[model samples]
Target: MYFVKKSIVIVIGSILISLGINLFLVPYKVLDGGIIGIGLILNYLWGLKAGLTIIVLSIPIFIIAWVSYRDYFYNSLHGMIISSLFIDFLKTNDSLFLINPVYSSILGGVLVGSGIGLMLRFRTSTGGTDLIAQFLCDKTGINVGILIFFIDSFVILLGGILLSTDTLFLSVITIMFVALTTSLFTRNVVQA
Candidate 1:
């Protein structure tokens, strides 16, 4: 039963994240944070597939997780791979969610936040820098959410410089929504 529930969470979470990225974020050249943000930067810069970049970028993080947090390694590998694949698979569907960039940022943030939040609830996540944040949280006893926000902010700053000023500003909105929505989903739930 536990396995089944986690599998379901991964699938739904991956889909929501993919839709949010390909449909909402991609169209506006906006970005999420962490590895996904990096992936978007690559995509915007070179037409690279975001999912592939995420998978490739996540390798080192997963290796670290394997060395220290065995459970996180085993659990998040599937989430990372599936979400990355879903991001690429859904790339062809980009025009599906066209809207005002601000609206896109809010809705995209909510979708991604919900996906990530659900996975985190199940003790699985899309890994990448999220895994790094988790590792930092464990070692430093910092709040995982705060760490994630910081990582995300750095990514947004880099993206704004690489992409455009508008990307930086809109991405701030997206991250705020993502963080808020993630908080809502994980509210009262014990962190794993």
Candidate 2:
């Protein structure tokens, strides 16, 4: 039933997002946004595990959701845990295929965005900053997509300062792709 469908979607979405990170973004030092970006920054700067970093960074947000947004907490908890674990586990795998950094960024964005959109469609997501964005969206009536893009851009800018101009440029392209794809994929879904 609905639970089974949601589970399957979450699993598939998590795998796709993990593949995008492990096979494309990580190799090139490109970043997505939100907790994932933070995780990547930690990995780049300290050799920390990106997934573990995501989990750690997400703790405060999850705690907030648990207290004030129980439905969101219930919906997103498994998605967050599964996706984070998959991302960490899949990091050991070799890249699926070699390609230019630009192409990798685009493909990574698409994969990650599609995964996120799919989960959102099912009323679930990988949590983290996404939950914050959702809460803001509910209160402000702004498009969640736009909020996510702005948040992502801020992260990428911070990353640019810490990483490289190339990282920033490529990440901008990646986030744009993610925004477009997520919007398209979630057109009929409830707003996140």
Please, what are the lDDT tens digits per residue for candidate 1 over residues 62-139?
888889889899989999999999999888743876789999999999999889888878878899987887777668
How much lDDT does each candidate structure score? 0.89, 0.87
Model 1 scores a TM of 0.95
Model 1 stretches astray by more than 4 angstroms: none
Quote each prediction's TM-score.
0.95, 0.95
Error of 1 at 7 (Å): 0.2
Model 2 C-alpha lDDT per residue in residues 1-192, reported as the tens digit of each score: 999999999999999999888888988899999999999988988999998888889999999999999999999989999999999988864676679999999999999988888887888889987777777877887766677788999999999999999999989988888877777776676554
C-alpha lDDT of residue 5 in model 2? 99
